[model samples]
Target: MRLRLKGARVVDPGSIDDYKDIIIFDGMIEAVIDPSSPYPPVMLDSSDPSSVTKGLKSEENDTNYSEAGKIGVDNFPVEEGDTNYSEKGKVEASPTVSGEGYTNCSKEADITEIDLAGMVVVPGLIDMHVHLREPGQEYKETIETGLKAAARGGFTAVCPMPNTNPVNDNAQITAFMVNRAKSLGGTRLYPVGAITRGLKGENLAEYGDMKQAGIVAITDDGRPVENARVMRRAMEYARGLGIPVISHAEDLSLAGDGSMNEGIVATRLGIKGIPNAAESTVVMRDIALAELTGARLHIAHVSCEESVDAIRQGKKRGVNVTAETAPHYFTITDEAVAEYDTNAKMNPPLRTEQDRLAVIEGLSDGTLDIIATDHAPHSLLEKDVEFDRAAFGIVGLETALGLSLQLVNNGSLTFDELIEKMSKKPAALLNINNDIVPGNPADLTIIDPDAFWSVNPETFFSKGRNTPFAGYHLRGEVYMTMVQGTIAYHRTDGGQ
Candidate 1:
């Protein structure tokens, strides 16, 4: 079907001040035309109560095209001066205007002509950090279930972490995950290989073979590689294969018996604390290793001002490094642990307010490349345990976009900048095509920036309901998500 989306304010981050109407056909964009351009000879009818246009037929050749035809102006409003305007002694105009000489055609085009007033159309988001626990931990999160949540969250593609019960360290497991996500799940999945055998941080995993099997990157998330020699060797091997070694920076020696961030909040709560040095020390070490080996290194879930300072200084030098921080780290602080809420207890635990502000500053000043959810799902039974013994992650697949818009709506960042950080920058970092043009894949997200709604965990698509923002009101919800030209998710709450 040919879809002529008229009068859409397209937001393309690749260009400056670029907004135009677009035409999509055969699952790909055909043209970016002006809003007032003439309609094609054949157009679909949008007047019917049903939204979809029915029966593709010719409109110009039929003399009775104005007889409530399905193809020509089914219910399009007649222009002004089109109703019985007589030129002195000319024939009287019909009750309705015909298609002839309709220069300034009605803003209405067809059912296929989607009106995008007050909306921003951006390239679909790509999350380089996700944990779709399949092949072993289906109860926690399967490929199909995780992709559904990703679609609702407006992510067109995601890179799954390799930390399952049987870790994805071999080509066979990576190939199986790729095929399962492609055939069963709707969202695009890029499998990440393990940095070490079984994530034990002793023996290096098959970096060369995994890259050959089409893995985008390698990392042992939730388990940092503590051995300097092993991590350095892994980095050099990954560099040889042209893939980045994403590091979950942490020094277990500093994090001894600690469950949360080290600060006044932890002291007041009488809980063990993990000092900020634990993360910053690893960041400093990784930067030195990257410099020594000349390999691409990426830091994940970077928190605290020290880590940011280390990354900033490394970039100032010539070391090839990139980093991403989760939304929780930027919005929440260690003070949230005052109530002993395990949902707020995440790895690289939330730091002080000063550190949170540092993360925001890093993102705004371009020191941070992307914002990911780190969307790890845990069952309710596992999360409802004692605060100290409970899990260390939260469900964020469905709330990442809403929380991001809150930042923009509150004057922290611009709309175009948010889109770039969420969609284009991550794609470029992971070496993927950021397509938002004609003949490109129909991967796009439609967002209503002004829409306001409160988050409810019961309404989440993921089985995990361990989010801290559950009753918090947020603005800017995703109205529709399209993957490969197919409607993957559509809001039914009329929030749009």
Candidate 2:
């Protein structure tokens, strides 16, 4: 099928223009043309409606920590006077003309036209760290459900952490996860194999075999490696295999029984606290190891000022290191955990306002290389418990982009910079390129940057319904998500 995406803003460098028409065919971008160029006037007939208007108005600084609604089906809210998805605004593309129409070398009626007026379109976003919870915890999430959440959040590709029951330490499990995602038909899944056997952090796993089975990186996530010698060896092996080593960066002894940031808030609540040093100390250690091993090291979920300083310094020292931060770290702080809120209880937990400002500075000064969701998902049963005893994550796949755009809203990052952090930089980390030019896969995320919406977890597509941003009014929403020229997700205001 062929499609014409018209009137959308494209800020990704090499995507053709500030505003242009994108012609996609045969699972690839066929052309990026000037809007005024010779072509049929783009139109939307009973379109999905998601791309039409900027969404509801709300504050990004909302601080409520209440639990969101119970998970619901279809979940997405329906606007008044909408039609069925399958029947409305279907892309009636003709198979005969194929790629010719996209090049402006032939007639235009051969392909479907999707009018994306008043919308923002960019190269599909990518997240290097996420937990799809498959292979063992299917009750919490599967490749199918998790990718749907990624699509709704405007991501085209995601790398899932290998912290499952059996762990992805072997090639067979790695291949199984990748193959499963392929069969599910949504976001591209890049599996991260365990750095050690069963993530026990003693013996190195089959890195070479896992890389051959589609594992792009290696990490013993959910828990940090306690053995320095073992971690160095894992890095050495990963360097030889041409895969990056991702470090979780936590000192368990320092973080013992800690549920939230070790700060005034934790003391006020009388709960155990995990100090910023718990994360920064490990970041510093890993940076030193990466320097010695000459291996690529990526610090996951960096949350404090100390860690940012460490990462910034490492870059200056010419160490092969990169770092990422989640939306919550920048959007909310440890103070948000005032009500014994479990949703905000993530590992490398949220920090103080001072630390949050530092993260923003890092994002602007290039100290941070990527903005990943760390899209951890946990079931309601796992979360609806005492804050100190509950799981340590909240679902992030759906809110990632909108929440990240808060940076743009506050001038910490420009729109183009935001797109880069969300797309290009992450893709570069994976040693891949998704430039929006001809002959490239049609991996695209079309968004209504002005579209406003509430953080209602009930409408989420993933099995997990926990979110710290729930009840906050936020701007930005995904209009359509395309994977390899096929519609992986379309917000139906009314059909396929």
Candidate 3:
């Protein structure tokens, strides 16, 4: 089938000149033509005899024509002795109309022409960290529903964390997630392996076996490996196996009995707080372990200024350490928790304005490598309880792009830079495909960066509606998402 997406401003971040008009045929890009090209034949109007002249007049100023004045009534090929014309010039008959050709070509080719006049066509997004809540807790989010949310959010692929009820520690469970996601979900789900058996943080999970089973990375997630020796050993083992150890940077001892960030807000609300040191201390220790063991360490949802500084130093010192931050960490602060909103409650809990500014700075300066949704879903019954009893997560897969674009459009980040952080950088981090060229998998996202939208939880594809940004006006929206050249999601109705 031939599909032509014409007049789109293709933003391929890997290139120097980011915008171009691309032609795709048979699930691959045929060519990237300049929008100024005049090769694509314009359809002639059969109803009006004067239509051909109008078409020629439109292209009269084209650079392909040297003398625009040469085209006139004498040059136009009109029907000989036609009553519409005063005189007959060199009569040139209209091209033959082939009914059979039109039928056979239209049927066989299945040409789909899309005029994306003011849209930006970018490589489909990849999220390296997300929680689909499948295998158990399907009431909160299933593999199918989570992928649907991902597609709506312009994500072509997502890596689901290994924190299910029966954690994805063994080869069988990892295989189960892969199969279910492939057969039943819209977005590609790369299964991550648990760092420890059942995420107990005591005994290491089957690292080599899980890697053989196709798990992308290993993480305890929410449950950090607190013991330095245990973490060091896990890192060394994972490094030997050529996989990364993702840490949920937090010292639980310092975070004990804490419900929010240690700040003026927490104090005013009379809630125990988890100090920024809880996160930074773990980041510092992990960087040291990574340097010592030469292991790839990834800090998950880093939410503190000092932690960013630690990661910056780790990179400067040539430590194999990378980090990702969630949208909430950069966009929201402890002030949002003033009303005891459980939606704002998340692990590595929302910190002060200083920390928020620090996260934005990290993202802008490349200290933070990727922007993930961390789309953890919990049932309303779980999140609607007391703030202390509420689950530590918020549904974000459906709103990740919009929130990221809010930063870009606000001049905090460039569009190409945002695409790099969201799509190519995440794929590179996970060692996945990061191509926008021909013959590559057609995982692409179509975005209207200027489209304004507001968050409405009722419209969310995920089962969870625990977003703190509900009803907040945001710019930019995903119009369509494709995975492997198949349309995964399309917003037929106009977005906000």
Candidate 4:
């Protein structure tokens, strides 16, 4: 099958960022044609209204296609009276032509020209850190539900952590997660194997075997590798196998039984607080280990200013280190827990506004290379409890983009930079190339920059309703998400 997506502002970093017509065939990008390029334009048969506007009805039909776009196996949106070739114009590309058509090349096959005007198309977003509680804890989240949520969140791919019930430490568990996600088929899941066997932090898991079984990286994500010697050895082993070691930068000893950030808010609320040193000290230790072992070390979910400083200093020292900060780190702070809101209670708990500015500055200056969503999903059973007894995460897959867009709205980061952080850079760290170009997989996200929507957990596709952003108004939304040339998720209502 052939498809033509027309009239969209394609914001592909390191490539063309113009109004182009993208020709996709058999799940791969065939060509990206500039609309201004000179080529013969094929005319449509106006006498046949069906040929003029396929699947779209006129005013008399009483079936308005423009009100809310429809997705079918054989039909795409083509509004009546629209002229953006993507809408009303059609170029019948001859299969025999080479470098002589509206596009540089044409396949003499049927093309579904979709009008994507007023939309911004970018490479599919990837979240390098998430928790899909499957293979054991299906009560919290399953692979199917998590993938559906990811697709709806405009993520074409995600890397789940190794903190599941069975702890993805062996090749069997890694293979199980991969196969389960593949069978579900929507968003791509790259499982991360545990660094230590059973996450005991004593013996290193078989990195070579797990890598062979489709594991992309290794980490003891939910818990930090407490033993420095074991962490160093794991980094050394991972470096040899050409895989990254993702560090959950936290010192449990320092963080013992603390519920929130140690600051005025915690003091006011009379709750035990986790000091900033709990995370920063471990971050410094991991960075030193990465430097000594020459491993590609990645710090996960950096929340405090001290940790950001440590990562920045490591980068300045020419260490093989990279870091990611989640939207929560920059969007909200421990003050969100002022009323003891359990949803705001997360591990490496939210920090002060000063730390939030540091994370924003890190992203702005290239010190923080990626924006990942530590999308930990938990049911109400775990979240509907006292502040200190609640689980340590909030569901992020559905809210990451809307929250990250705040950076662009405030000029902290340009739209292109935000897209790169959410899409390109994460893939680079995993040693995967996700550039939007000809011959590459047709994984794309269509976004409506001005669409306004409120955060409603009842409408969320995730099993978890644990989020602090509920009832908050957001100014952007994901209009559609496509994976491998097929629409994985599409907004079918006029919620905007």
Identify the leading candidate in terms of TM-score. 4
* Over 4 Å off, model 4: 36-109
lDDT string for model 2 (1-496, tens) is: 6787888876675444477777787898876765533232222244444221112112132111010010011122234444332232223221221222243323444667789898877888998899998889999998889999998888999999999877999999999998998888878999999998988988999999999999999999998998999999999999998889999999999999999999899999998999999999999999999999999999999899999999999999999999999888988899989998888889989999999999999999989978999888898788899988999988898989889988888889988888888899888888777988778898999887777778888889988887888887777778899899888889776211
Ten contiguous residues minimizing lDDT sum, candidate 1:
84-93
TM-score against native, each model: 0.85, 0.85, 0.86, 0.87
Writing each residue's lDDT as its tens digit, candidate 1 over 331-396 gives 889888889998888888989999999999998887787888898888877788787888888878
List candidate 1 segments past 4 Å from native. Answer: 16-18, 39-111
What is candidate 2's local distance difference test score?
Answer: 0.81
Clashing pairs in 2: 54-451, 55-451, 55-452, 56-452, 83-494, 84-494, 85-494, 85-495, 86-495, 86-496
Q: Among these predicted structures, which one has the highest lDDT?
A: 4
For model 1 the local lDDT of residue 189 reads 88
Relative to the unseen true structure, what is the Cα RMSD of model 1? 8.2
Tens-digit per-residue lDDT, 124-174, candidate 4: 999999999997889988999999999989999999998887899999999
The residue-level lDDT of candidate 2 at 176 comes to 93
RMSD of each: 8.2, 13.3, 8.4, 8.4
Task: Give the higher-lDDT candidate: 1 or 3.
Answer: 3
How does each model score on lDDT? Answer: 0.78, 0.81, 0.80, 0.83
Q: What is the Cα-based TM-score of model 3?
A: 0.86
